[model samples]
Target: MELSWSTFLLEILNFFVLVWVLKRFLYRPIQSVIARRQQDIDARLAEASAKEAQARRLQDDYEDRLAQWRSEREQSRQALEQELRGEKARREKLLAEDLEQQRARSVAVDSRRQGEQRRQLELQAMEQGSRFAAKLLEQGAGPETEARLLSVFLESLAEMPEARRLQLCAQLRDTPKEAQLQVASAYPLDGGMRNKIEQALTACLGRPVACRFTEQPELIAGVQVSMGAWVMGVNVRDELQGFAHLAPDSVGG
Candidate 1:
């Protein structure tokens, strides 16, 4: 083919025109579509990243709440355990105190019982001793010796206070109406006893007194004083009876 300047120029113009049309129309529109697509993809990627971040935050929050709940539960459990332990300790203490009190009460009761038994034993021993002494006194003093001793004792008693002497005189009365004092002896009246009787009667009656003695063997070797309704007899048999009354428990022994 032979080259022509006009043809070549036309071809060149055609080529440039195609390029301008593509650039001004097709190329520009396609480029705009591509740019918009790229923007959409970038927006989708950003949204995805944001959602992932939100999910991660929510998970962390849930984990934190779970941990807090677990911690609270553990604390409550520990506190409950401690409360139970304290209650158990308190109960044990109370039980111990009760047992101690019971033991103390038992000890006191036993001690009291033992003391009572000891007192009873002591009383029994005293009674026995008194009886033994009485028996010995009975065997030692006879009727005659007892009479002589009674006369001396009366003399001493008469020398006591005036009230005591009057009381003696009153006790000698055999009855309430017989207030006068009288002294009588089965044996011969001794001067000493007679004088002592007179003095006692003089003091008792506040006047001169007289005492009579009659020989009566049936009265035994003793003196009997009668004052009205009252009569006092000094005899070994009476003394023995008084000794028996003093030690009633030891009488059988």
Candidate 2:
């Protein structure tokens, strides 16, 4: 409570000394520690920023790889579809060609079979017609037809060529005068017809000739003159045989 100059001055001096000690020993060291802690915090923040940028770059690369894979998968799927379509079209075309070939072959075979059947029918008809004609002629043969055939035969002998008559005369000249000239017919010849035939033979040969008459039912309404190897005839049997030979033959289809 007493205001003394000396004591006051002493108190002021102690206060100044305490301030210098705190500045030198506590304040300066505390400020140094705070600066070091601030530097450590700044370095950790820079490292965190760099790591974040690297993570972003990695994510972008992964996304690009995924997009490229999807594009490649789409391309492969489209190519497979196109190949399947082409293969299907080729198989269908081959099937169509094979079917057409089979149809054409079937048609050709059917046509050939039809033609063979028609030919067989025609041959059968021809054979039947020949047999019918032969039966009809056989039933119609009689003495009237035989007489007409004999008359035709006599006329044919009268119309014989001079050279043919000479050949016949030469052939008969080697035979004996007493050799019989055989005259065959389908029916019995009357005496007048026989005498006429004998006279004609005598006139044709330029010599007298003996005669012999015979009935040959197999002649079928015609005359056959025979002497040794020489023979001539015109008969219904010969005509029917020629008609039968005209029929066509059957062949393999």
Candidate 3:
């Protein structure tokens, strides 16, 4: 290639002009588009970070609400258990009191019934005793038995009062006027029962009394004085008969 000063100058000027045109028209517009794109990318990243923070806050809130509900449910369960236990204890106490009252009532009823039974038995025994007493009084005296007759009469005479006995003696004195009657015999007339009877008759009659020496085996063992229409005899047989009528339970175990 041949080097010429004018042709080299003209080539250098054309190269400079082409670089300025590219910078002003094509390179500047391209650089502006790239910068705008980078700004958009940064805005998108900031929006993503905000959304993540909001989601975390919502999750925390849900967890707190669930914990509170669980706490309330446990407290309610414990309260219900306590109420049921109290009710059961009260029921048991009531049942025990009822049973004790029933037991006391039963004991009282049994005791009253036993007392009634004992009283009934005693009444029946008393009725039987009265009937026996009437029967013994009906059987009268037998004759020819002096010792037994006197014993029977003496036992019957002892039952009367002293005033009533004097009245009977006065009646006897007026009735039998020479009847030579014996009056009251002395108690426990030991060995001289016959002599005592004769003396009493002598005094009541106002005359001498002849004593009879007759033994009456029919009479059980007592003095009997008889002077015409008036006779009194005490007999041991009547005593034995009265005792026989008593109930076995009254005398035995």
Candidate 4:
């Protein structure tokens, strides 16, 4: 409680000395340590922020690449489906074409078979008709028929073309031996008929002609005449054979 100036002044002086000592050694060193720790904290925080930004950029890039991969996969699927459809359509078209060609071939083969059958039928009819006629002609032969055929033959020879008559005359004259004139009939001839034939031959040859007569029943109903290499006949058998040999097309021709 006693106010003493000296004591107070001395106390004030001690207080100033304590403050200078704390500022010079303890306070200055603690402030330097705190400033260095603060600088280290700020540098660590800046580094953490930069690493966080890099991680976000990496995540965004990964998302974009994933999206692109999904889009490409879908496009590939669509293209593959379209290609498969096109291939199926093309194969179907080819199959259809092949089937049509087979149908056409079948029709052509059927037509050909029908034509062959028709031709066979025509040939059969012609053969049957030929056989029937041959039998009918065989039943109708006689001396009377032979006489008529011989007379017709003589008439035809008399009315022969001038050129053909001349050719026969030349052939007969050029023979190395005497042109042998052989005359025959299916039926035997009497004296009167033989004289008539001889006169006709002599008139046709324009010269005197010698004759050799014979009977030939195979002639079926006719006369026969030969001189050297030349032979003439008017017979049912020969005419029937020529008719049998003719085909349907050749009959009209």
Instruction: Give all TM-scores, in the order shown.
Output: 0.49, 0.45, 0.38, 0.51
Sum up the clashes in candidate 4: 0
Pull out the clashing pairs in model 1.
173-229, 173-230, 174-229, 174-230, 175-229, 175-230, 178-228
Best by lDDT: 4
Off by over 4 Å in 1: 20-30, 126-253
The lDDT, on a scale of 0 to 1, for candidate 3 is: 0.59
Task: Report the lDDT tens digits of candidate 4 across residue range 1-253.
Answer: 8999999999999999999999989999999999999989998998998998998999999999999999999999999999999999999999999999999999999977886677667666777877676667567878888888988888987898889889888878865444557887878999998888888878887888878998887777888888757877687767766765675555334
Tens-place lDDT digits, model 1, residues 97-198: 999999999999997788667666765666676566556655564556646856665765555677866776565443343234466555576688677766
The lDDT ranking, best first, is 4, 2, 1, 3
Q: Write down the TM-score for model 4.
A: 0.51
Q: Model 3, which residues run further than 4 Å from truth?
A: 2-40, 102-253
Model 1 Cα displacement at 125 (Å)? 3.7
Determine which window of 10 residues in candidate 4 has minimal summed lDDT: 244-253
Candidate 3 TM-score, C-alpha based: 0.38
lDDT of each: 0.69, 0.80, 0.59, 0.81
Clashing pairs in 4: none
Report the number of clashing residue pairs per model. 7, 0, 17, 0
Root-mean-square deviation per candidate: 8.1, 10.7, 14.1, 7.3
